[model samples]
Target chain A: MLLEVYAQTELRSRSQQHGGIAACLSLVLLLLVVSPSLAFAQDQAVAIHLIDMAQDSELSITAASLADGWYDESEDSRVSGYELSDGTPVKFADWYHTDWPDTRVDLLTQFGDDFGLLWGFSTGERGEKYTIDPSLRVGFVAQAHPAANSILSLTVRAVAWGNLNEQTCEGDYGEIGGVQTVNCRLAATFLPPEETLQYLAHAEPNRLHISLSYSASF
Target chain B: MTLRLKYLVTAAVAALALLGGASSSIAQTTSPVLRSWMSPDIADAWTQGYKGQKTTITIVDDFTSSSKFTGNLGTGSLLYRHGEWTRLEASMIAPLATIKSQSFYSGTTVPLAAGLNVLNLSYGMYARGTYSLSQLGWSAQESSIINYAKNGRAVIVKAAGNDGIAIGSVNAAGNKDFLNLALVGAPSALFVGALTRNGTVANPASLASYSNKAGTNTAVQSHFLVVGVESSKTGLAGTSFAAPIISGYASILGSKFTTATPTQITNQLLNTARKDTLLNYNAATYGMGEASLSRALAPLTIR
Candidate 1:
């Protein structure tokens, strides 16, 4: 089993899927070297996720205002505030993930033992217009095995993610492959936040990030 | 109690109830539909029953109907659009004011109506988003505007233009351009620049990015003022929208100063504008400042 893990790691390192997954695999190996006994004792299955935060909308500050001066609330120099379409002022921090619906799964797969942390996507060099915000998804997983084929395993999992607080939602529909698809839409979407980190820190009020279910086949 | 005494007491209470109902009704009529670009003084003026009543403001821009009369839509709606928009804003700020619109024509003459005190000119000659005195050289159309503004009874609220460029200096020849005559020379002419949004005047950032600013040592410093524009619907922002805001303010003041000339009304708006409300306040940028209808109506604000 030790030799098998080594060969697979060597193959994965040589293959093209290098940055995000390789970083997670390197950590698992470091743990095995730190405590060899723990690694040999148990049979475990772990899932690793590399999450890309939902593309956030721009800050409520109007573009024309930003072109001229920053909206510095501390100095009371404000062109506009995050608000509803009707013009009621809301806090800027509460405006995170208020428009985008779901986080795109950049990378998600289980490794040998347990799920690992998510990290940044550093695959290519990007310019000023491109934004990179990554997150780690953590969740509860339940596994089941039938008696006749005990080795054949399956897992049921529930996951949660942070999303918009009080976005005015409406229905949107489009046609694909001669079929109509329905989606939830924002009545009015704001511009993306001025800074990148603003996407992760600010959370929707009274609402946990979105939760999802996935049946794992191992 | 006797039958007659009971009846008399009931009648007295009913009369008192009627008076109370009438008072509330008057309050409702005074509440104007204020937009985002409007300063607080607009609402304050409305509360005092100043909705440009008994004042008629003529919109003197090209309605795109230079050859014919178009009701609301015209061939030059883009050019005509500004006049229509000016009327919309003017109505919101001054619901009761009578609005008369006139389109510009090169050789044809359009008469200025009697008792018209406010002229909203939300169009200008080609400035290309930069200020140049040469761009506004004397023309037939320009002369008509100048003659009307020079008319003592009416004040013309002109849009500085959308070219975001500073209104530049006069040439070495010292030729007085139409913009120079309208803004600096005439007491009844007030040029307006655009603001991104309204509510506060102190923030210089409030000026719309596309709105023109007066250059240093120019008449615009004292003659050009800025106000917020409504870019929500049209998806466009310019000094054109800003002019009507001042036009509405002038109309509101006209309701109060029934006997005052256009020059007096123009002076009242400029003199009482909110200067202290702006950051790094300057005449070149702010121009007297955002017109305060409340201040224009009453110099001392009664709490």
Candidate 2:
């Protein structure tokens, strides 16, 4: 009778152990299935949070006060920035010359985390008689990293001129005929870091941006 | 056992989805197109029948490889047919035609068929003197070619010699008398000069700067037209190449407007030229400015 009781006890213990192992195996399988989806969601949430941080960082308004100048005029610059309806930040760089102050405008649109587009336009007086004419350009910008502070941009543009005026002077009197000419350019711009905001405000705004521009896209 | 089977299936599905996403990203990248002077955009213009039809051109030159020459012509459209030749060199060979001896034809014999044919002569023999019609001896050969042109049997297009010296300059060699002087004094002949790719006039109009130039003198200037051609494949810089482009233009004109005479065609090209910096009514550098196809083809009105 004692042996029968011990045998029953052994069977129960064995069954319990088996049940525990099965439950553990099931839990491991569930984790394996859910880990990748969980990781993807975490990455997306982190990206959104970083974008929000960048948009709320700071705004600089140095470019708003410059005046337009002539063909040979000195530096003309303007700046403005704001958050868009889609949680994107939009920036403006306005260049004014003595010729056509109201006609010049440059715009940048930044999206969450790492994507954006930029556009620019300029028109002014060329010489004593002819208008320099209006030009338009558009480009794409992307953040190099998740930090979203620095960006690499590619620009394609077309410029045309009309109504060239000729000047008559001592020995310089020659007929200046009107011309219609078209040209294209590509460029890139870099944003200042949050820490460098004071330096940018104090430093002569880095208008000497480095970019490789081509005459034709093709 | 059922739980184990579900885990294995999920793992397989995840692996497959990752692989599919990677493949899709790779496919998103694309190659860029290359640019050329003879861009596809320009070539498309010819395929649409922009080349003129029904106008004939006569080519006069020594050793013209008719096969190679015709192949180039076919690129623009076949607007010309071969004609009789006056052999100036024993070594000269016609790649496209059956060559005959120089003396068989009389000057009065008509070589042209009526109704808008352009005569393209890639050859020139030098005869030195001031450009004067009387100064050029009218041989039976020269006279007949002239008469046909005068009667509008054809419009004669002659290549200005590649001799680099100004046109009408006396050749230093004793063989000056043998040079054919048709371009100097002949009103019937349109003397064509070569231009570099940048549209600048080429100096020394001969091979390797050996081309003849239009003289500021009245005779040479009266008959010349400048055209751009391909010289160097890498750096286009020669007039010989320019001549072909002009021929291509002429062929297109001939094919498009069958009713226009050679004179009308010539006038249209001259009238439509864009003025250059020189501003002289007619500068020696660019005769009637650069040839423009768009302006030349504007619709005609009865005056």
TM-score of each: 0.44, 0.38
Question: With candidate 2 superimposed using the best TM-score fit, by how many Å does residue B250's alpha carbon deviate from the native?
Answer: 2.2
Query: What's the TM-score, to 2 decimals, of chain B in model 1?
Result: 0.71
Here, model 2's chain A TM-score works out at 0.26
The predictions' CA RMSDs to the true structure, in order, are: 21.8, 31.1
Across residues B206-265, which tens digit of lDDT does each residue of candidate 1 receive? 566656666674555666777666555334456756777788877776665555678777
lDDT per residue (tens digit) for residues A50-150 in model 2? 01000010011112221111121111222132222121333322221122221333343434444444454443333321223444435544434223333
Model 1, runs deviating above 4 Å: A1-218, B1-32, B65-80, B127-141, B168-183, B199-205, B232-234, B300-303
lDDT of 2: 0.33
Looking only at chain A, give the TM-score of model 1 against the true structure. Answer: 0.24
Cα deviation at B300, candidate 2, in Å, is 8.8
Among the numbered candidates, top TM-score falls to: 1
- Given the true complex, what DockQ would model 1 score? 0.01
